[model samples]
Target: MFQVYLIDDEIWALISLEKLIPWKEYGFCICGKSNSAKKAWDDICKNPPDVVITDIRMPGMTGLELLKRLHDSKMKTQVVLVSGFAEFQYAQEAIKHGAFEYLLKQVKREQLKECMIRLFTFLSEQKKKMLETEAYSEKQFWTQMQDQQIKRAAECLFQIEKQEWIGKVCFVASCKKENIVDKKNGKMIQVESFRLFLLGERDENAYGLCIADQEKSSKSEEIKKFLAQVSEQETVWGISRIGDGTQKVSEMIWEAQTALRAAYFSQNQILSYHIKGNGWKKWDELSRAMYYKQNTQVRMQLEALKNEVEVGAVLSDELFSILERIDYEYKKSHGKNLKPQEWIRECDMIHSYPSDKEFFRWLMVFFPVQSEVGSDSAQYIIHLIENQLANAPTLATIGKELGMSQGALTQILKRQTGKNYSELLLEQRMKRAKELLVYTNKTITEIAEETGYTDLFYFSKTFKKNNGISPNEYRKEKRIENEQSTNEK
Candidate 1:
């Protein structure tokens, strides 16, 4: 609703206007009323209204004077002037002051209503245009501001000249699930908030931030309070405490990100603060051993494994070998016993995966791993079944072991594997029967019993479906092949 301010020196006239006009119907509400222009101007300045209806002449300040004041102040209030005396000079002055609608006090109610309607329409159109322009400008401004924030953050870290003044640097924390406040204006956006924050001093610069919105706290208190609140929020954060300005802020950013990575393995969900220690101060002693390190080669091998996974190629031992070498070099360089076995296990898991999508999903559950492959329900179900098939006597039993009802598993297996439980079982058993037929001197009845089919004729039918020949025919062919191989040898 449009807010309105009513001003008239005559108390009865103000009362009459208040009663006669259907203010709500015209999308208006008389937020305030005043007996003099001075008082009205004060009210308007404090809480400006959309429209102002005022008498043309008043004792302290005339309507013309009020209009001039509003114009000078750049208030975009729509004005309507009401006067008893219809002087030409007053009408000319009203027009000059951009009065929306001029009216005589003795005018008929119908005429006044018509004027009010026209004014309302005109004001409505102007409001709409203004809102559209504001929305458009807001979008553009926000986009540019975000870009500037990223650039400034990068400069604060990487640009060496900017680092000399910085006393300490901080990395603001965010989450994938939470909303991100705009770095510049703190405006809320709908996008998923995942941003890296960089704040540091330039040469000889120090700024303080309070934990709350009150007066700024001391630097130490600010850091402590910030860390305390972050802990209470149960939100994880990777932070670098006060450090020398000699090291680049960008390096701190990278370290902070690395800290977050390490934190991902913990259950705290809030690794609130971490500060890096000396970078091998025993440099000459460590540098002598560093020559034997294979850091570059290890990183390259990891990249190759990542590339193979990205393209949905089968995982190779080459990737595992690289991880092992990296593990070895890391142990030697840091003089900390790094677990090559852990890397070996992780590599085995990745390499043993049948497809990239499964590997990627497993990675997402533990660590962030990207595979440019989409999921297929059929392939996934088959893989799942294949993994669990060793524990059950039949496909139905396997489905039950996997927490699915027999019917649902049956339908899913049919849709995904293109074979119903019975058919799949028959195929598996038929292969077992063939192995018995060639490798062991088992009778047809014995073979049938061993393959989980008590009925010989039914077993033969299933054998034909799988091998394109009956059990006896398959056995005969195998015997002939075996005899020929024996003679050749």
Candidate 2:
């Protein structure tokens, strides 16, 4: 119900209006009454009422002056001015100062009720119009934001002059499909393949999912679920940290875009700037391990670095730098030269792997060991072995490639490397299996297939014989070691 305040200099006049007017019947209640216009003015300024009824000729500060004061203060309270015959001119002046209506000192029940009804209807219509205008303004602001009109968009989205804007955060989801529907309510704004949300608005606020305080467990879970629902195999999301009321929306958008690029390049589905620490130092450690040909150290460090990336511990530029440095260092050490097109294709394949271990396995194919015997035939044999490890090539296949008998190839391998052809092949297969076990998130069966072991039990027995542990045990040992090393550091 609307609150009404009654004011008059005479106590009898205030009491008569209070007792005669059935305010509840007109959807209003008299919240206060004053015999002094001065007190009424002070009360109204402190707690502005929806409707104010005041006499024109009060002891000090007449109703005309009070109405003028309210108009100057820009209060939304509607005022009804009352006057005696001596104050008719004062009532006209009250009207000029924005009073809702003026009434005689002797007000009838019907006349007062009519005035109250009109006032309520006007307030309702004005409120409806204001809400509609605000909705339109919000829509326009979003449209302008999509076009990146930063200054104009800010003007529409915030009431800067009134200081009414609150802090906000933005999220951008790049979906695999063009027409992805938002399962978490229809609050997300779709722009092309991107789904964007501003988190300060009422409808968009989910469990207080503000990016500024995303480290909180509840907020983190909300964000995780949101990303999972929107993301597919090729989809990812980026979130911007909290931006203050005055910060430009365009800058927030750019931050989110940068984070999204990081997620895309790192093959992680979600990333944010708010995560603590940097992954560059860990990445550098992995690079050093690779440079020194410490295969075990490299695998361990790579796994640690992948964990850091999944937790949003790296920036996009730093991750890219690490990747490029690895490529450059590998090419320099191996003395392998590739044409421009070939290098591009190889880089594409390296980036296509979803996990660090898979990427490491793909990279190992390029740096196959050259035979230490230094013979042209020996080098060719090593190349064949490296190229066909996935096929588990035999002595007969090597002899056919070299245009020699299997017996001759066997003698050459035994004399030069102190191991037979089958022993050498087993060593290569076991070495690859260990690398896959340490580095990839692939299952045991998948790793076995990749290493040319069709029988899971046979692969497990061979791995145990070679490494003194099963594949799963080896992975666990390496992971524990990585965790210990990380803790020590």
The alpha-carbon RMSD values of the candidates against the true structure, listed in the order shown, are: 31.5, 33.9
Model 2 TM-score on a 0 to 1 scale:
0.35
Q: Give the TM-score of candidate 1.
A: 0.33
Error of 2 at 135 (Å): 36
Whole-model Cα lDDT of every candidate shown, in order = 0.54, 0.63
Q: What is the lDDT for 299 in model 2?
A: 60
- The regions of model 2 sitting more than 4 angstroms off are 1-166, 169-218, 225-235, 245-248, 261-269, 273-279, 283-291, 310-312, 315-317, 337-358, 366-489
TM-score of each: 0.33, 0.35
Candidate 2 lDDT, 152-238, residue by residue in tens: 333443442243334333333333333234545433333222223433321222211222222232255665665565545445666
Please, what are the lDDT tens digits per residue for candidate 1 over residues 1-489?
Answer: 577888899999888877777765555667789889998898899999888988988899998888878877889998888899989999898888778878888656787678777867777787668766865674554346436654564454345334333343433333322322233533211111111333322222211111121223225445444544423355444443334344434444434443333333332343333432332133333234344543333333434445543432312232243334544555666554333122323334444453444543432221111121123433444433333332214555444434456786667767667887656655556666788898888898877765666578987887898779988888889999999999999
Candidate 1 segments exceeding 4 Å error: 149-489
